[model samples]
Target: MPLFRAEHGGAKARPRRRRTRNMEWVGSCGKTDENGHVLSLTRLCLLSLANNMKDMWAKDYADNYLDHYSFRYIMGPFTLLPGELVEELTWLLCTRKQMSRAALHLMLVPQLRGLSLESCPSLVTATLCAHIAARCRGLRSLDLSGGQQLPSKVLCETLCCLPALRSLSLAGTPCDRGVIKAIAQRCPLLRHLDISRCHLLSPAALLPLGAPLPPLPLISLLALDIGFGEQEGDPAAAAAYLLLSLPGLERVAMEGLGQACCLIQQRQFNRSDGFTDREGVPRLVELWRDWRHRQGTDTCRTMREAAAREEEEEERTLSDGFGSDSEEEARRDGGPNCSQNQTEDRKRGGDLSDDGCLVLQLKDVKGISCDFLDSLSLACPNISSISVHVDDFENTRGESQGSLLATGLQAWSAQLRSLSMYHPGPLVNLLPALQVACSSLVSLTLEGVKIGPHTPLLEVIKACPGLRDLLISAEPPTTPWEAEDEEDQRAEQNLPRLANLCSLTLNFSYEHSQMKPVMSCMSLEKVLKCLLAGSPLLEKLSLVSLPCPLNGILQEVLDLLHLHQYFFADSTNSPLMPLGRVQRVNLLRTDVTMMTVRSLMQRSKRLKYVDVSYCWRISQVEWMHCERSTEVQVVWL
Candidate 1:
């Protein structure tokens, strides 16, 4: 396992998995006994184990490992105990490995949020939660999912300590109905709460859900979820009118939302929103719930699951339309009138950023004029991370594309160490702009962006030597040569080659010129001499569109090249070189055979990532007949 260290003063730690036992013991102790006989055993025996476990704590090495951006976590016995748990917890909340950790946390946290850990099986629940609650002061979101060992009292004390808790997940938590109501009242600031498997929750347990508070009144709650039995009590009524009293909620997700669909559909609001009255309210709660139940059922498992939605849902209304909640005093606050949809958008936008880092999340702002973006740039100067999605979204017609503010980007590139942009044109256009505008653009990603003519992109890349992620579409150069004259030729010659291409993918769609083997024996002999170069730091490569060679071409070339032992009979094709520090290369639609792969393995000891999708020839061959590529990841799709 390899740990990748990023410049953000963070690193990743890899997990070492042992398969011998359900609980494999790994300690930093070495003991030798000739007869393998113990004289005596007592609490002293376990103490030795503990001592050995404690000895494995090489804090310096662990700290170094924690400094990386990505790594696989391998648990050691010493690091899994109660005290050791604290150390592991501290290593993450306080160290590097943050990029990879953020990636993993983002993936799991959504599912883990609002879960109760009274059912966690791997550790002593009460002791673990108590310890974590005491130390993890930064735990704003908790997952007490399936926490089988955490008793109600442990949860109560821990819940009180977590004043900053914004989300609580009690799915499968063993707390009784009484405990649920008490905790809800205690933690009124909670925005999201899940009581999913409280096969024990009742309306009485939820009455405290709307208990009033004093002075500022703690009315910041927003979301609540609960699972319904085939025929449970009125948990639905408790959530509906109960939330109305607080007067401040934007979104909610719950199971068995079919019944609540009736309430929202019958309620009155507005037609401009396609949500007459409260008709659209049900859509918010069931969207996530629908995704959860539809997982693996020919439906989307993710919420922003736009990729899988085949069609839009129909609309219906219950109550009359057009009015504010004058019933609540806070609703009477004076403000210039805005469209209800704009108000809803503002409410949703204000949902999470209070404690989290400042963000520039501009998505689907249809026709946002240059002046609008410029104004925004002036407002959020503290933003360090940005996610911009301008989909077919156009600026004001006739406005120069240059008018949209790049000030925010320029500011971010200077202060930010992490940048992720998702736009086909802006990403490519901004590359050179960023290089010229900011001195430090270390960690940046340009995903799914169409970079026109490879030359400009190459120019930008060369300019930004500090770039760590240059992910771009593999489209071939639209204009391979710009040399109308000698001056142009000289400039083209100065451009970088495929050698420095750290990660590459040859566009499968573009015009692909065929790679014919050397015509003569002499030329065939020279293929081995052409050493691979310029692939330093190259971990992944895809050679797309190279069709399988004809049988005669394959055999003749193999023998002509003197590849009697399949492709690498000579010393030239030995597997000892990893170009540009590359660890792996994937062959996509290539004509190369297993023999050629064998030559690759024989030549490069660092070989990894060899996968073939939709290839039938390799599927039929026996392992003995086929030469194996000693690699880390091999997938035959």
Candidate 2:
């Protein structure tokens, strides 16, 4: 039996020292000293020592004690009492110019005005601008953010350098735009300014910056997030448009943008009768009956037709994708290009900019709407990689719409090659995303979600022929909600055929046994006929549990592993029967290890590493009997 331990990095305990003091008249610690001999202050340093030091202090005083005391030795910023003592100690650490290591730390303790130090834990001086504002009076373009406190004097000092100040950021500092405008009026060259999360200001603060000056400078700003907390009083929907209207402004992030996207949907989509824009689709479908009773023939037929059309659409897309009239309505909305991206668009209400770099996330977004591309417009033209979260919460009543919303995010920046999503329903959007430069699109991650049977998971893998890394959660439908649709099953079955796939993980799965197996799987020709399709291009496979063992009925288990290494390693059109290294295999308490598990391990010559815990009830010795017999390591824990 092997021991499993939670790895921890810590300093070893130090030995305790006796706490002693002497007045030279001492009989006991509580006894008074005779002759009234007073204790020497210098001696107190040696006598007033720590007890039980072994518990907290480690042995090597400098190596362990001082090392562990990083930030721990000095009480934090709050503990420093305001006095000359602080300035004296700070000077002691700071004046040691020879000790370059201590200079930055010495400066960090001060809450002085006009100072800044971003993420760096240590800095010799505050940011260039803040330092000058504190020490030099003639300078513009100040940046004093993230570090020591910002007093009004320092803020006022920096603001004095206006018109020449083209770039200024007072982020996380305590200064308002009123003070900012007082400076802006004097400085006309202001180009870039970021005052995000400044609680004391409002949009009206921009008035001074907006006032025109000669040279008619077109100062473009990257972003502006200045405002009060969550209720930063809603900007006119035209605010962003108006800000961009400024000649030089290209990008702006005013609030928690992701949350703002949701809020925008809530506000514009909210109807007075306790209904939302998306909820209207189903309401419209229901209205068919009302219209029929009211004898509104044309309207009733259209509504009836939408209900009929919706029935044929996939459930996963219902919540997020087009309803029966989705296509027709979009067409009327001037979207004649639905055909250009029908496979990718899951939900409506998204528009791609002419440059395809920007996307306009539109109103009434219920799920991951095509509207997601709306935010793509916010990114710089050069960005090619991104991480996105489409769903923050589950909407069980609108699963179809949720999926459509998630899948509709296919509209992407031309440069996109890697994408990650967390908590979105129907991860199938990966299919449409793959269409944008298939072979070049390399890395992808899907967290806290599942791809439905209707989603072309297999088709996506096949299309991304050169894919190197992939992470996905496969939770196959557990119950048969409707009659089994063969085309849906075919799409799912094709997933495990990605011969070029390198890394893979099925975080978890709820897929039923009824789904057909992969198309390339040969041995299970008869058995897999019932359970055929799944992911195949996996160098790293992590499955919490497998309902079926790789060797038992999932016949492609060994063969797929064999094919993957051979195909990728040889880089040949012809199949190489003998494969190479299985770098890593981690299986946690899976059911597929009963029969062929031993044989599979014994045969995989390329199998260099493995972790099989609570699997097959097989012993380490039994596993060692397999092909990787030359060397073996096992940890039961």
Candidate 3:
């Protein structure tokens, strides 16, 4: 009976034995053995099982496989010792793989230094928080971006427990002032924090005024992103308050459109173009500039007296036992805390130059008056990049505002390299500023600015000699151009200013065009030729919202006259051949055909990425059937 049983079970027994033999074993000697492997608890097997585990969703197959009883025993003798457990688990599950709360719980080993739980929906739960607190006690960096399911209270509580945490990201989390205050009090060692999109957070939570409550423990925070959120308090006041409090803050990003809406709603403030009672906001900005500048200037006797008053107030707080009593005296005499002593020394020496921040990105300032811009530019002299939205000259009904905006820009003339502006109205008055002020400007973006037939885009390009990147988006001219006169005008127009341009984007809105494809295509080719002639080093060209379809007629016209070769050819054999180095062409939101795209791809050897997105003529079937021309990546989504 035993012999018969062995014969029947041989089929399964043989494979099981072979599988065990194939498993690589790491014994106590720290050497791998395949053959002579003992099934003792001391030995571990580096399991290399199924290859199909990659197809599974959420849970990483390797992590799941490692979680198996036999595999866990092999890789780690994860013993519960008395001292802290150290594990280098960074990037252990960072491959766009989602891990469940249970799986995360299993992986949470004590003494984890870094952990990134980005995009994990189940990351913030009672059980998970308990696991993190108990196991990940020594974690230094924690990233919880896109975890919207995480409750603010739970998040604050979890973060408060991790005292050693240095970097934290609560981006997209529904956190408020309470959470911010908790972080300030609990996470004193935090060096970097991202609270972007936390709409409920009040600015006062970060910089409480009236009397400094023993000074915030978040003095170590170097970089902050408080961008894109609806403020519960006045943002301008909050910004000033923050600058006065956090002296060590180096980089700040406060780009949001909410403030603009509020400003536009207040029509009473729009009295006159001239600086008057109507210009109270700009005056406030100027006052803020003075107040901030006075923080470190000792030469000014009046400012010194104010500083003396503040110091005395702090001393009074110490006498009331609210401050660090012994440390307060030591700080006053300049004993320990070298950073604090240096701050005090700078205060006494009237040195404000070192107190300026490095980068300040402020967006959606269209509702903000030019005076505010002026004060910002003068106040933050050390800033290298400034992004602000200014009221258009057309909407404001005067050139003075545009001139004022330009004048404000001159404050950072030497330091400024990149300038981005969104002008909802006409930009005619603002052109003079670009022409003379921003000489060191390397990149310029002008969006939503109307350009009539008389608009001198070429002149704007000419103003910045060092300008390498230029983006201009505007509605197409309402008055249709006379086809007969356009050719004559093209012959006289010169674009010598675009010689240094490397990237050019000319986006037009088709909402106002009255011309047919035949006329529009000709006009497009003419404009392209003109721009290409001027930009010899141009590498990226995006002609978004084309007025006509790139179909058979356009292809035939180019083919018959051999214009395709001149426009797309690598060599400068033809006089009309543009010597420009264009590598990518984006024709998104147009009516481009497969044949036209194929021809363009075949001719331009340097063209690598061709985006014909939303082009209805190029069907999905046709795109799939089309041959890959010149290794070009044609995107037709």
lDDT of 3 by residue, 39-59 (tens): 432222111101111333213
Weakest ten-residue segment in model 2 by summed lDDT: 358-367
Q: Mind giving the per-residue lDDT tens digits that candidate 2 earns over 262-381?
A: 333333322211221211222221222332233334334554566555544534355576445765564345432333443232233222211212223221111122334344334333
**Candidate maximizing lDDT:** 3
lDDT of 3 at 432: 71
Query: For every model shown, what is its TM-score relative to the native structure?
Result: 0.38, 0.37, 0.57
Native-to-model Cα distance after best TM-score fit, residue 531 in candidate 2, in Å: 14
| lDDT score for residue 237 of model 3 | 43
Compute the lDDT for candidate 1.
0.40
lDDT of each: 0.40, 0.42, 0.53
Report the lDDT tens digits of candidate 1 across residue range 220-275.
Answer: 22223333432352444444334333333323333312233233333321211232
Instruction: Estimate candidate 2's alpha-carbon lDDT, on a 0 to 1 scale.
Output: 0.42
Better of 2 and 3 by TM-score: 3
RMSD of 2: 24.2
